[model samples]
Target: MIVTSAPRTKQILREVWRPLALLFVWDVVVTVVYFVLPFRAPSLPLTLFGSVLALFLGFRSNSAYQRWWEGRGLWGLMINASRNLARAARNFLPDGEAVDLKRTIVLRQIAYVHALRCQLRRQSPDQEVLRFLSRGEADFALARTNVANGIVDGTGRRIELARSKGWIDTIQQSSMERVLIDIANAQGGMERLKNTPLPVQYRLVPTLFTHIFCVLLPIGLVETLGVATPLGSTVAGLMFLAALAIGDDLVDPFANTVHDLPLNAMCRTIEIDLLQSIGDPAPDPAAPDKQGVLW
Candidate 1:
């Protein structure tokens, strides 16, 4: 996720460089056209068109940002639920069974977080995930098509075993079940966001309008500015392109881009918190150098 800091003007400028280059080329082309063809100055209608295009770009960007924020919030809930579920398991189980069963459940929950992260990023569940489960259990999960679901299933089985052994009462079992349900719901919400895309028609509308405005900008300025028509057109083009690119950048929140939610960091956080709660030695933190280097 983007850190809350003062705006990075240098980073924003670097991101806009490509559009700026394109704008320069566009201005040159417009200047040549103005001299070679019978072009007239822009009309009032063209200025209004540019305004409408700007509004469309703004709206699209705002909508994409909303989706990205909502996805991040859902993962926040998952982190809380995982910790709570482990606490409940430890608290409600019988003293004799509590240590082992609680540890097992806690580790499984950690595995679930890692598995979900891998699934969302379309990567394989690695050895880090296996470290959280028993050899047999890990092998079983590795054989499954959905590692996240497999982890949840293992947790449910452990819960059932605890109940059968009289380690937990019916009420405690039910509570644990509810927590697992919440985890599943959180997973489903994320999948929904990952799978569903913004409507194509809506996406196309801004690009079409922006391009139209860019094309007509030179004609409008040429009559008034002469050779400077290209310069004016380039400036206008860069502005429109910046708006469009920003909107495009936000359309995919789950991507492993700098602009995306820090899923790997979040999963590591869940691991550290859950393992610490169960008295296990915490793993060393991953390198923080690339924490915010996504595109």
Candidate 2:
């Protein structure tokens, strides 16, 4: 995600420059046509159109931002659930045989988060996930269609094993299982967001209306503004264009884009906390790039 307080002007210009340039050229052409021809000035109800268009853009932006925030909230839930599971395993499991089992469970929790991150991004988890698991276990998890869910299932079975061996009592096992359920619920929410998208009308209608307004902007204002029609119309149209871009950029939070959530950084955070809890050496915290983007 972009960690900067605000987006750089260069980036914004880059995204909109092509269309803005076209609009500027179109505005100039319209102004020239109006002055050269002896045609009557077209009177479009621009005020009414602008008001209705603003409402549509506003709704679209709000809906997209809600989806983005929900995705981040779900990840927050997963992070807490992961920590709780690791803490429970470290404390509840007995010493002796359970020592190795505790370490395995903690590491696997790290693997599970990474796998879920990769899964949400539609990436292969082989690099981020395999190193944390035993050869047999890794094969078992990777063989499944949903590698992250498989890891959670394996962890559940391991917890049950610890209970059967008397490493943890039934009550303690139940507590750990509750944490796993929370993790599952968070994963489900993320999946739903990634798979489902904002309705087509929300995406298509605002954009179409915005462009229509822009094309008609200079025509409607040419008689009043004269030579200044291009400048005034383009500026007003640019606002609506930028508003449309905001909704598009934020609609898919899981996408591998600067506007999307920093899933990689978040996964590394879980790794660091869980590893350090078990006295293992963990990687340093993730830092943003020179441009202040965290990935």
- Tell me each candidate's TM-score: 0.89, 0.97
Top candidate (lDDT)? 2
Locate the minimum summed-lDDT window of 10 residues in model 1. Answer: 286-295
On residues 104-182, what C-alpha lDDT tens digit does candidate 2 reach at each position? 9999999999999898889999777877887787777898999999999999999999999888999999999999999
Q: Report each candidate's C-alpha RMSD, comma-separated, in the order given.
A: 2.6, 1.1
Query: lDDT value for candidate 2?
Result: 0.92
Name the 10 consecutive residues with the lowest summed lDDT in model 2: 6-15
| Model 2 spans > 4 angstroms off | none
Error of 1 at 41 (Å): 3.8
Task: Find the number of clashing residue pairs for candidate 2.
Answer: 0
lDDT of each: 0.80, 0.92
